[model samples]
Target: MLALAALLPLAGASFAQQKIEQQMSYEQFKAAGLDRLSPEQLANLNDWLDGKLKVETAKAAETAKQSGGDEDRRGLFLATSREPVDGTITGNFTGFGKGRSFTLDNGQVWQQIDDVSLTGVKDANPKVKITPSVIGSAWYLSIEGFNARAKVQRVK
Candidate 1:
């Protein structure tokens, strides 16, 4: 019985050693195609994945900014393609108010102003007006023979 017990321990040890020897190295594992990833390849993949994630994150942030808050208001003004009649043109505001008005080419002249509701962007309520000063510091939307001015405000 004592001899048998000693041989049992030796047999276990040999079995364990054999099992360890059968294990493959990293390189051999790759060669077998079971684990075909090199360290450099893994690093490059990680870097590329990180870059893609960053770009997606940035794009998401930009989209969120454009869709949220009062400052996200954008304006589009369509001008008449025809020649101005007596320095006056007509157009519509496509962003906020579906307003139509006549603009004068000369400063210090005011025509008619209207208000409208807009959706899909920031600043739901937009106020629209037509001014004669074409060189104002405000953002201007002009097309061919028409001009539009859009001002965006955030609702607190």
Candidate 2:
């Protein structure tokens, strides 16, 4: 239900207008001079709205996937972003074993959510990528040339 609410904006203009109309109370509809619609006409209107809703939902999903705008990434934990981040880790590249935080050269600060040890690379200001998660506002940070990554939430 929450996802549907979030998706309403992606629905096309006509569908959005219909959705608003469908939500109107009977009295509201009458007040709007739409209560003159016969039973058959109302049924037909509802059928048309249902079909439009389905198409709009599918289109929104496809758009989200094609644009890397969905949550959970395409396959790995790493996300896709329109503006791919190319920056350096401001400090040593260690594992996120103890609530480690990453401060990028771009001035973005992200903290690891869990104790996921993403080791095997230790460098000062190593080039990395940070992409927005498809599902939520959370972001994923990864070390360059490495598969290790962590789901991070921006703090500063």
Candidate 3:
């Protein structure tokens, strides 16, 4: 029992580290093949990536909305390359100006804007400002451009 206890923390830490590494590796793998992700995988990845984008966009929008009349009109926009490569970047843009709002899934609202465009990147460290739009009805997200647009709605 003592030996087991001694190893438990190490085991847990290793497991946690492995999970993080796996997630990173999976992201890398996906980014490397932006043109060739399986439909299912692509769908899943887009959903995941969009979820993160929504949170950041919403925060920026809320801040801008609250910054009074003196606030800048530019909105924030962010985009990440669906490529799998090491040291790849996740692109981001701030101050995108105003955009249009729409309904998404699950009684959620989103604002859509066409502000910035980025490609061949992976992760974004700095938060960006862009347009926010609804994802079906339940969630709000950001859409960066026309060609790089990703339409994601709820599943049933």
* Model 1, global lDDT: 0.31
What does the lDDT read for residue 42 in candidate 2? 71
Clashing residue pairs, candidate 2?
70-134, 71-134, 71-135
Best by TM-score: 2
Which parts of model 3 have CA positions greater than 4 angstroms off? 1-31, 69-72, 75-156
By summed lDDT, which 10 consecutive residues of candidate 1 come out lowest?
7-16
Tens-digit lDDT string for candidate 1 (29-101): 4554534456676456445534544554455345545655231121111111111122223233234453333
RMSD to the hidden true structure, all candidates: 29.4, 14.5, 18.3
Error of 3 at 9 (Å): 35
Q: For model 3, what is the C-alpha lDDT against the true structure? A: 0.32
Candidate 3, run of 10 with poorest lDDT:
7-16
TM-scores for all candidates?
0.23, 0.45, 0.26
Order the numbered candidates by TM-score, best leading.
Answer: 2, 3, 1
Error of 3 at 133 (Å): 14
Write one digit per residue (lDDT tens) for candidate 3, span 1-156. Answer: 132122122100101112212333556554555436566765665565455445544554455446542222111121111111111113433322335333322232334434444345443432222232322111223333323442222221
Sorted on lDDT, best first, the list reads 2, 3, 1
